[model samples]
Target: MSKEMLNALDALEAEKGVSKEIVIEALEAALVSAYKRHYGQAQNVEVEFNQKKGDIHVYSVKEVTEEVMDSQLEVSLKDALLLNPAYEIGDKIRFEVTPKDFGRIAAQTAKQVILQRVREAERNIIYNEFSQYEKDIMQGIVERQDSRYIYVNLGKIEAVLSKQDQMPNEFYQPHDRIKVYVSRVENTSKGPQVFVSRSHPDLLRRLFEQEVPEVYDGTVEIVSIAREAGDRSKVAVRSNDPNVDPVGTCVGPKGSRVQAIVNELKGENMDIVEWDEDPAIFIANSLNPAEAVDVIFDLDNPKACTVVVPDYQLSLAIGKRGQNARLAAKLTGFKIDIKSETDMEEFYAKLEEGAYIDAADEVETLDEAVSESDLTADEYENVAIEAAEDEATAAEEVAEANEATADQTEE
Candidate 1:
């Protein structure tokens, strides 16, 4: 070690944040190993570094014993007393055994140790920097692409955009900048590994936070999101302040807020629906472009429901290949079975006619039961008329409630 090496340590502490004490400790250990390897000594040795003087020293240690069995590791009391009068059997002594030409070896060893520590320190700094960004979003430039991953440069570190995380509608090229969601950050043996995604549902959520002040400041709260990357997504939002309309706030003036997000996602469709406390109303809202006539819950399964829509809007409510219903189910955390108005009517008719059986009863349809009973044609006609009247009245009440809900939403 020299004065120049001490200056380098100060520079490393200031610039790279590596502690001088840590480097000195590592250097001492490396010097001890070097001395034993080069000098071929079997004696116990210790290495120490003088921080002020920047000097390295190697010493041979031996335990004082009554009788010295090994000349290399033990010093007899007679020999120990010659050096120190208070020497005891268990006392130990050190002799300066630093080789004259050891400075050259020390310099080489110090260089290797400092370089290794610097690399490790840099990795720690990068890992700490990126760990804060986990589950957040960041902008990065595309660096390169291989068969498995697309490397994105996120300032201090290169993040990996895997095949599954990449949006199907987007293409990556060198120098192209894109916003990505930080799905995970890992400290691996090689370095810090940052995993980002373009297709994550939260990516949409974060974009809203960035673009919409109401969403970021907690005025409009996004309750749930269901996304099919590169195609369409549904977001359920609610308002903390009664005056704030969650959907309109998220949509911004003239759809500017959501339109910006759509552009970022490469023209992906967005359906922002108002979140309601009532599961029936929420499920109906989740159907978006399609109007749900009525929502019927399953008595046996609390998490399941059937949504009835007008026969003309059945395809729209179900979306193309059931995408709308699927996303709605995901958003509301329910199993949604969509049925047309006619289908629901037929279902009700079957129920009234005893076509559907209870768990404790034998399965029998209307015709089967009627053949076994002494029911006249006029009695059957009366039953049919009563069922029709009941169905009509129930339908009217549901329609009135739905209309009131729609009027309130519009206001």
Candidate 2:
């Protein structure tokens, strides 16, 4: 042991978080093992470590007895008394048996033990540091990609973005920077494995927090999210402060804030809707880009709703392949059934036109809302068909005007 050894321990403590005291203790134990291996005998041994002098001493313990039966473990009374006059029987004594040539072996053993402990200490530090970040968001650069996974370098570690967690139709290249959600962290024997996801719903929520200060500070709360990664998503937001408009806050000035998030997500369209306690109002708002005339909740089954839109807007409300309606249902936790006001003609002309499968839509005459009994089935059919034609013509004009407005906005 020397000052150089102490200096190295201090460096380990500062740089690797390895305690010098712990390394000293481990080194003391290793010295005892080396003593036993070198001497090739069974004897009780004790190690003394002096921190101030950076010194290690090995001692053999022996019981003081008047007659020594085992010379290796028992000291003769004469010998004990030579060192100490008051030495008595059964008193354990320490004998300095430090090997003269042990310095070289001790130094080698200490180096190996300290290095092993430093690695373990560093691993524990990293595991604890990253565990706090589980389920949080991080920005990382694409390191590489293979058929099975994409490796993203997240500052301290390489995070795994598995194929299943990747966004639909999204591509990545080397050095591309993207934000990811830290979904899981596993402390494996090899190392800490971090799993990240780009398509997680919370990724969108976290992006909202990053871009929208009101959301990050808790003035606006995200109620729900439904996402079709790389295509579209819907978010329901509510304001904690009544004065602040939650939807407007998320959208920002001239849509700059939301557009930034959209660009980050590779142009994934997002719809921000004001959250409402009343299911009727929320369900209506969730159907964005489509005007809802009325939303009626099923009294028996609250998870179901009937939404009515103009005949021409029905296609927009249903979306291509009913994507809009499906995503709205997921966002609001309700199963939605959509109907058009002018679909009564299709219902009456099922033999010729396609059948109107929406059972909730029972269209009535234009004069007044007709009950089931006011007119026979045939009379109701005749009145509904006439009213449907008039509604259809008016809906077409509205649809055309909406298209013109959208085109102008795009320009």
Candidate 3:
């Protein structure tokens, strides 16, 4: 029995990662509970296990009284003195109460206590193991599927890949290994329930971190990422080193690095663009696969922009259903309106024509001049020339006066 108890403690220490002392303490508690169950539940019983001696002892504490009413709690002074010569009235004493039936009860209680303790210890182990992997990418095998979710084995624990967290049109088969992002860990009555996702934007970032050495080493930085998941995604990258190309490094030799990531994503297309400090250039790069002719900023309403692409690439710039253009607007935090070359030319022409007509109407309204009143035909030419020169000199003097006034105002 002593050997079996030592073995249980050793197993608890090794398997459940509990200390030997803790297991021994749990054993003592179980024995005390067993003593109470077999004897009287109200008995003030204590059980002690000496680790070195392999001895187990049970004692019941009773208060000394002149007259004992309840024998379980109080002992008469005369009866206590019979058991112990030092016993005196009003003095508490402990009497041995190791029941013969206690060994059988202890065995049953030990099983229940060990099972409960081991289960709680296992839960703690699972929590600790997965907490370290939070916000990381993990690979798991598809174990089975219910109507609304799929269960995956992540080697240490099972994770749920819910239907909502899955990418559209992506499917998982039994025993298939898939990569997922651990989104959340929940503690429940049963155990730790981990929720994983494949559609999250961070999944892409983490994948790049895994595949791109520059990212891990701090030579290259991923600025932002946006995704539509299973269809297309965009990432903005920048390089700290002048010589090292961030895009080229992420793309790798013959597109090896990016291809690996793409294959893992189940052929989702990726556009790796170089991030720029200038918003105009950044937005232009963000709408790749179609060149941006120009970016027009509307400062009065700061959140709007107009982008022009070539007429033929208009559909491409806007994507099949404006996915590219919409993502660009979101990525740059602007209301993007895409136009083709033809649309831009027509708009500019209308503005120029309006300005020309305004100028013509202004000229038509100006009728009389001081030079016209001072003329004889040949003397008119000379008079007109002199008046023009005089007017130029007067205009120059007025401009000087305005500059002096402006300077004074500034001071």
Most accurate candidate by TM-score: 1
Assess every candidate by TM-score: 0.86, 0.74, 0.78
TM-score of 1: 0.86
lDDT-superior candidate, 1 or 3: 1
lDDT tens digits by residue: candidate 2, 1-411: 888888989999998989999988898888889889988857889888788888888899999988889988999999999999999998999988988887888888898899789878977887898889898999899999888899999987899999889998788899999899999999898878899999999999999999999999999999999998889999999999999999999999999999999999989999999999988889989999898877756789978978878899999999988889999999999999998965633533462222232211333335466453578789978877776776665556555655653453343
Off by over 4 Å in 2: 37-42, 62-93, 341-411
Candidate with the greatest lDDT versus the true structure: 1
lDDT for residue 82 in candidate 1, whole number 0-100 = 97
lDDT of 3 by residue, 1-411 (tens): 366776777877897797778767888888887777666568677788767655677888899999988988898988888988898887878778777766677667767877888888888889888988889989999999999789999997889999878988588899999999999888899999999999999999999999999998989999988789899998889999999999999999999999999999989999999899998899889899899988877888878888888899999999978899877776777789999978976875675566555544443332134343654678656655665565566556555655653453243
- Model 3: lDDT to the true structure: 0.83
Local distance difference test scores for all models: 0.90, 0.86, 0.83
Off by over 4 Å in 1: 355-411
Worst 10 residues of 3 by lDDT: 363-372
- CA shift at 340, candidate 2, in angstroms? 3.9
Residue pairs in candidate 1 whose N, alpha carbon or C atoms collide under 3 angstroms:
none
Sort every candidate by lDDT, greatest first.
1, 2, 3
- Pairs in steric clash, model 2: none
